[model samples]
Target: MASPPPHALIIPYPAQGHVIPLMELAHAMVDRGFIVTFVNSEFNHARVVAAMSPSSSPGNNGVGGLDRIRLVAVPDGMEPGEDRNNLVRLTILMTEFMAPAVEELIHRSGEEDGEEKITCMVTDYNVGTWAVDVARRTGIRSAAVWPASAAVMATLLSFNKLIEDDIIDAEHGSAMGKETFKLSPEMPEMQSAHLAWNCVGDHDQQATLFKYLVKGVLAVDQCEFFICNSFHAAEPGAFSLFPKLLPIGPLLTGERGGDKAVGHLWQPEDAECISWLDAQPEPGSVVYVAFGSFTMFDRRQFQELALGLELCGRPFLWVVRPDIGYGKVHDYPDGFLDRVVGESGGTGRGKLVSWAPQQRVLAHPSVGCFVSHCGWNSTMEGVRNGVPFLAWPYFADQFVNQVYISDVWKVGLKAVKDEEAGVITKEHIADRVEVLMGDAGIRERVEELKKAAHESIQDGGSSHGNFDKFVEAMKQA
Candidate 1:
């Protein structure tokens, strides 16, 4: 008798944030007895290999001995040496390039083993429509993975009505920045300013992103299962919005263990941050700060944030990437580093690096609070680590994630956005950080939510149960 199919193809969106959660989910599938093939763009595949330590190899089964998980690369259709200065062009290329690459992977997987065809596809929600096309063409099951909180997805779905009512336009014009609007009756707490600004960029760009989003949402209707990186209890209102949505989150389980799992698109994670964290005074005594990969801050704003950290008088680990501004290297204002060092009495309680091992840093006992951009991956990591948040939303679903963190879960406090100046002052930042860290009542409230977040992802918890159901459904499909 012939053997059963031996592989599953997992395709995630190319960004670091999107890839990490999908990688965790793929690991879960591997643990449950499946051959996993994680596909990445060629550029990303090289990065992942470069990032891995000898011990971190995928295993005999492929790079560290993940045993069942294999990494594969597909072309992303960019020219060999294209300029990446234009965000609009990059976005367009990502959408257009991926479809053919994914289709080619399906064809190649089918040819590898006659009986071991591509049984199913696990893909990011943004890639949903393409996955659907591949599934239809190849006769395989496809599932959509929403690597975002349920609340954010619900908010995106509401844009259709905003467009219908002429409150928002499918194309950008003078009307794009006219006034803020509310999302839906269900999400009355969300304001129009919180919706993705990409929706209001140049007309063609706006239409392209909206088109991709709409197609992804509609493709969910055809998926065998819809997976969300969220816990049901974390966003009850939004959880109720989707018929097929499955919550399987706080995805960074077993983080403290030494097991090496490959992330979606990998870069050489700076492990030096771990040693710096260890040298801190005590557990839960330091603040961890990071804006997700794509967030860029102007020079003045970056200085204010640095000054705010100093003014708060807290030990901190801040990750400031080179591309944080419109320059190659981040240059702080004069004497900023000197001021912070002097405030710490020359012991350098503050450590700033371009990148860090985020999971390990979050899980570190010394981390007491997180000042984050409210990206979904970071939010889940914070919740899982039982840390409270100081939310500074930048773009995309970040604003919606902030709503869940501050308004819904009550585990976070939002940074005030300045309408006229378009910048937050150091004083405002210092005040909020102090309130979140020093107030006993606020600390207690944050801890309560942290406990609840932990419970939601534990065995027999809502997220855990949903994960099992999702896997079972995939088996049946």
Candidate 2:
């Protein structure tokens, strides 16, 4: 009989944005003849299975190659039905509560007979030092994966220096009066006001997040090899900082020549949106708008966004989930949907859904520009599809990503925010959308990045070679 394929266990932080790319990595491994087991928190495992179950929606089938890959779960030490969306709560749960359960799972898998013994582990960047220690104690080969941009990782890794220079407080809030600081001459410039954890919540919460990030960086320092879901050519300066870092990404679900197996926590509304795109009059004429799974906007911001898309008078597909505005209903401006979508549905001005098949939306030929919250996955998806963006960053690494997209990459434009209210108004959104849609130069740059992303994953390319090297190292270990 043939020797059993190498077994690997993949763990992702249990959030939608984090799970999506990590699932892409899992699929990539399975295609390479590895037996992959994907482990999620009990909460997310149910979410995934429920969202992908045949009964949920006809379109919501499981990930591609599902028969070959195993799905498993471990308790996250939360009371049943507790909210997993709170980042601070998740940090505490993963580090303080879930580590023992995860370690036990890792240990028990190795004790199993035959081909089921785990040969390696792929862990989320925030899984903490305990995971690395577990791998060492158990003798399993391991690597860390950062789902965000490499540039953001590079910045966070240098948080200690920022502390030493007094540019930011070590234990308290941001340093006074310094709006911007550069980590290094090569790193992209950063605004202190836009620091991932800055001003997110009250003082205690902000401090907790800062401490969590620092712990993650220290944990990353212990890992032998680190992987980022980004193309090498895209962020040269950022990649130069960490010698062990590997860049083999823009890791799209469809890139491996397999059927796209998107891991959506919420089921997409359906093929109606795709059909709508097909009916658009011109190629690259439709605008695609999605702000990712997180990010809650206030009532005023929501109204402004609705009016802005209508004001632009472009054919568009917008995904607006009910959960987008805290625990409140998403109340769009009065008569907004009516004005945009006529009764006949023949005018084809706009189509809206609670959720979207984003990769599919970006891949469509009618998609000219993207209005986005600039989540890392969305940024890469836009790049993969050659779609330029009108960046409307919400928070966290999104602000950092906006700098790269608009300033460094020059493939997108950042939306201007109102000075006092701190929201991007209808007028500002309309103007930026017009600028993005009309600019041939922006379109050309995005196409170039798209080609570069595609090329990196081809035979003998940088990403391909790096992935080959990674697999070999695992086998040899």
All models: lDDT? 0.72, 0.78
Identify the leading candidate in terms of TM-score.
Answer: 2
Q: How many backbone clashes does candidate 1 have?
A: 9
Clash pairs (backbone) in predicted model 1 = 57-63, 57-64, 58-63, 58-64, 58-65, 58-66, 59-63, 59-64, 59-65
How do the residues 310-359 of candidate 2 rate in per-residue lDDT, one tens digit apiece?
99888888887866353243376777757886655435497877777788
Q: Show where candidate 1 strays beyond 4 Å.
A: 1-6, 57-67, 81-91, 94-96, 113-115, 164-166, 170-188, 197-203, 253-261, 264-266, 324-330, 339-347, 418-422
lDDT value for candidate 1? 0.72
Task: Compute each candidate's TM-score over C-alphas.
Answer: 0.88, 0.93
lDDT of 2: 0.78
Candidate 1 deviates by what RMSD? Answer: 3.4
Q: After superposition, how far is residue 53 of candidate 1 from its true place, in Å?
A: 2.9
- Model 2 regions more than 4 Å off: 1-3, 53-65, 110-115, 253-260, 324-330, 343-348, 420-422
